[model samples]
Target chain A: MASLIAWRLVAAPHPASLEDYPRPPAPAALRLTTLGDPRAGALFWMLWLQTFDDQAGVTASFKKMDFAHLTAWLERILALDPGSEYPLLMATRVYGAVLDPGRQRLMIDFVGRAFRDAPERRWQWQALAAVQARHGLGDRQLALTLVEELEQRVPARQLPFWVRGLHVIILREGNEIEAAKRLMELMARDGGLTERQRQAVEMWRERLEELR
Target chain B: MHHSRQHRGQAPSRLSAVAILAVLTLRMALRERLARAMALMIALCWAATWFLASLLVSDETGPQAAMLGFLLRLGSVFLTIVTVTFSLTRDLQNRGLEMMLALPYPRGVIWLGKGVGFSLIASLLAILDVLALLPLAPPGQALLWGVAINAELWLMATLAMLLSLALRQAPLALTMTVALYLLGRSMHSLLLIARQSAEIAAEHWSAVVAQQLLTVISWLLPDLERFTVTDWLLHHGGSLTALAPILTETALYLALLIAVGHLELRRRAF
Candidate 1:
């Protein structure tokens, strides 16, 4: 059984894109290392799984694992300790769609579920989910709904400016250039826009001008 | 007559006698195979904690916060239980306990000394756990829980001594000790559950009876929950004051267990 599991990990077909892989499988009990405390348990199991094949002759079976398995492992860890920040942060920083789309969406999906399971930094995570929704999965409606939920959940100041900018970008991509320009102009009214964010908003307004 | 040191020249002071037993118990633990395995296990657990901490994106000390506390509470408890129980049983089986009882010292002093000696092994492990977690946990909290785990182990050791005396076999004594520790830790919640169910059923008599039984048991058994603040210490830095109740209850339990063992020894034919 161990050999078969190892074989599956090594020979699993590469997902052509982020959309290719299905949702991760449920975790088996043997994989759990929880001893009552969730956060500590989650971190411990994640590290142990990462280093499972670190013996002298082992081929490092952990690296060859596909996103499906990785997500399953991560899902189990998150289930054990939903409040931990490791799942969202590690998924974003380590797994990106640019490198492997399948792995990227796996993390994005993980983060989206984590957004509901653990609401520690819900707005920030949902905003990241919005970016992934439009760019990674090509679901503009999902992106819009995520941004909407993000706006409602947090204070106005806490919402990232880039999240608002993504709203304009999503609007432009949806063929609502006029609405996008109006939103961009509304953002221009904000006194707190950093110098770089203000430059991005000006670029958006300029592009809308060219469209006119 | 042979057991009486008073006839020869002078009797050993109570302090020296206990000191001798303490050294003997420490030597027994040093010679025990389980102590070595326990050392390796503690090191491995810490290594795993260090690795887990490294995987965090921000490399914060938060992930490592519970490292030593968990080791002290869960891991060291089991190791100490096995070591203390097995040593006691070995002494009994080999007739070594008989020879010790034949000595001039009372069984109370001997058992207390042995408990103290067995507790040192746990103290050493707790220290190692603290040093491993030194970089991860706040120093004050680490030291506080370190002392807490030691006191907890001493309490457990005395309990093991009493269990071995009562059962006269290591395997059964160890099993019973483990069960008692688990039940003690969860006793508050279990009693609450029982009483809540009784209330739901409208069985006033059952609730009253359960409360009376729990009160009696509480008087005899230390509430193991007092030692279970690993989560509090992990999430919020703990202060020395946190140990007050735990230490008090642990000392009380230790004293009771020794007193009981001393009485049990007096009644025995040996």
Candidate 2:
């Protein structure tokens, strides 16, 4: 019993959260290292990235995170399981929520590239990212660029009118009233919108006129 | 004419002996708490899967399905290896094998009985695993995953029995079985790495030799990567055509292990 007590005192373990972010291996190398089960491997790392701070019962501050290194991991994970939206969701919601403007911009840019890969499927994250840029980072230019890219890559007909008119709203926010009115006019002329969408567009046009 | 009739009568009795021994093997395992252990493990695995599912950000069930499939398959393989090997090695350590050999049944019947008994246990585990998966995965995909898990566990069980009998020590035999399984699972990835490295450094003869050695080893070992794929549960239901090679490799390997085990058993003077 004395020996056991002595051993316990000496072996008192201090568990610490992982604070340092390491760059992830290339996708091909990671696939090889995981014994070729890319799906499981990708998921394991994604979970690790998601819960790394609280792993040892300690919460590492988000400011401690190296967004560049973290972005690399997200990219590699998405490369491994391209169909998965978990990584992008993390980038837009969790990492993008960091108070550091530079890190927030980093996540927004990562979401932009990821969105380009599968525009139809990943447009939601891109949309969230644009909102983050405009509101969170207060970078209107970055927000406008993202909205333009989303408009170009995803077809206006495929999107609901409200989503299609995101750029017009951004333009109005930037005080480009003439451009916003012109774009809204063009959107109202389209015949493909649902009754609900057309009504939403009319509301937006009236609001823009009131603002002007 | 009298000799021929005697032989005919003995054949049926010998076959019956194998069947009886198989039943006895299963009963012994049950008495050793195999069922209870398997149930506990399954419950724990499912609970963990449920907890992890809530943490996933994706709206689709693919990640959850993949996780359940992976956990169940891994747990079954680990449990089968430990149970089969430890049971056989215990019999060997306690001189139970000698007592059994003193019985009237031939040595070959004893080996077949134990092998089939382990295979039956594997089937039960597979069925339970698939049932656990049904909530997360489509039924058709779950069934395919179940079949592959069964085949993979069958291979593990047979290999465990053979190694335990040959080595007659639980620790050594278990280690060897696990090592072989890990090698088989990673052989495809190892081969790819070797190929890439060799191509990158063509002037290095060591890389070429390493690649060739891995190729030969891969051919000798079962390609375990083809079995129990999580992708099958995540995507479209797996086709029967894809299962063909896995089943074939399992059957062929089981035959080879049985033949080798039989010869080893017969040659030993116990």
Candidate 3:
């Protein structure tokens, strides 16, 4: 229990960053049912891992973890509670196994549905997908598509104002300026913008014209 | 130099009387024959949990942490029941309850004071458990758990008192209280599970009857599950979204239990 608390304190600050060790294999031997509370189901997995770690130590057990186990565990957790954000977020962080594109794309697709369901979470996850598409997989087209989707999702109020005009922010970080401009226009029309936001939008439009 | 001046010359109001009762109840818990034994048992249980945790070969603490949490909650529930039942039964068996009723305070106030006192003892005990596990729980969650356990105990204490008043025997009252508690906690989950097979529910008249009975019982009973956010301690991000509603519901239920218990007490011949 003490160790778990320590891990949570450590994990909260660094989103998606886990300790450098392999994750344990899925507990396929345990005949579990999602018919009860999903939280309880997730707990079963946690306990299963802890049992493995007891003798080997946590680092050793986590080191034994493979990508397949992580993906499978997450998929099951999501199935049990699709709206549960923990599994999706935890899995999203680790899907890219050091620039290998295949697993990352598969995870992005898996989490995309959950991200869409959770509107507030859309920006961060879409940004992640965009990064995985661009640098990790070298699929610029898929990266561009994710950025466009992110642009549609972001409320103008949330994005920092002048930053996008001078430099592209989260959604358009890959120099997808045109998509950012279109999203800005939509926010401006939506019309709850602060004075700073409106000015930022006008400046961004001017900057867009100059760049074009 | 009047003794009344210590309390500002006011006749001890119902609140003061209740306060005295509560303090006395706490003292009574300590003085009870089982108090030391129970404390020792709890100590043994915690040591066992720690030992069991050590036995698990995994380095990841999540699994053992979960087990500890489950055991903590289950132990608390049992402890609350035992403490409430024992305290109330002793009071009834001895002449102490009659003495309290003989005092100038309203009968309802006496009942309320006893209930509050029982809950206070349970809360203190639960807090001790929390402190034992405090290093394991996160900053906000330990306090959240304290709130949850208090609410659950308050409800259970109210139930125990009600049963004690309605049935004079300790064993019978305790048996009924446990039955009611289990029914309260499981009723909703059972209904949800049964409803999944609507065709089965429809085909079997007995199933529909049981479902309806469960629905009624749940509506009347405290849902103990609402107070269990044990995972929030483990960074599961559980919300206290229903906190206000749960508090409101508990107050209403306690009020209802007191009214019925008071009426039952009144009907008894001295």
TM-scores of chain A across candidates: 0.62, 0.89, 0.57
Candidate 3: which docking quality band?
Answer: incorrect
What's the TM-score of every candidate structure?
0.67, 0.84, 0.57
- Per residue, candidate 3 scores C-alpha lDDT tens digits across A12-115 of 45333234324533332121232223454565553353343334223333334454655666665555444445455554554453445556776777666656
Candidate 2 per-residue lDDT, tens place, B182-243, comes to 88988877887788889889748999999999999999999998998888887745888879
For model 1, residues A40-138, the per-residue Cα lDDT tens digits are: 556666666555434444443323546676677677777655556666666665553445556566777777777765444655777777787787767
Clashes of each: 1, 0, 15
The superposed Cα distance between candidate 1 and the true structure at residue A44, in angstroms, equals 5.6
lDDT of 3 at A201: 78
- List the candidate 2 regions with Cα displacement exceeding 4 Å: A1-18, A25-29, A32-36, A55-58, A155-162, A175-192, A205-212, B1-17, B50-62, B93-109, B199-203, B234-241, B266-269
The worst-scoring run of ten residues by lDDT in candidate 1 chain A lies at: A26-35
Query: Which 10 consecutive residues of model 1 chain B have the lowest summed lDDT?
Result: B228-237
Q: Which 10 consecutive positions of candidate 2 chain B have the poorest summed lDDT?
A: B4-13
DockQ, all models: 0.13, 0.48, 0.06
- Supply candidate 1's per-residue lDDT for B197: 55
lDDT of 3 by residue, B1-270 (tens): 255556677557889888988888878877875467556756766776677667544444444444455566667667777777777777788978998888877787787788778878778767766675666666466666667767777788778888887787888988898888766766545666555444556658777676677678778877666665555655446556756767887788878887888898888865
Is candidate 1 or 2 superior in lDDT? 2
Judged by TM-score, which candidate is best?
2
Candidate 3 DockQ score?
A: 0.06
* Error at B91, model 2, angstroms: 3.7
What is candidate 2's lDDT per residue for A30-94, written digit by digit as tens? 77756546777778788888987674657788888788899898998888778778888898888
As for DockQ, the candidate ahead, 2 or 3, is 2
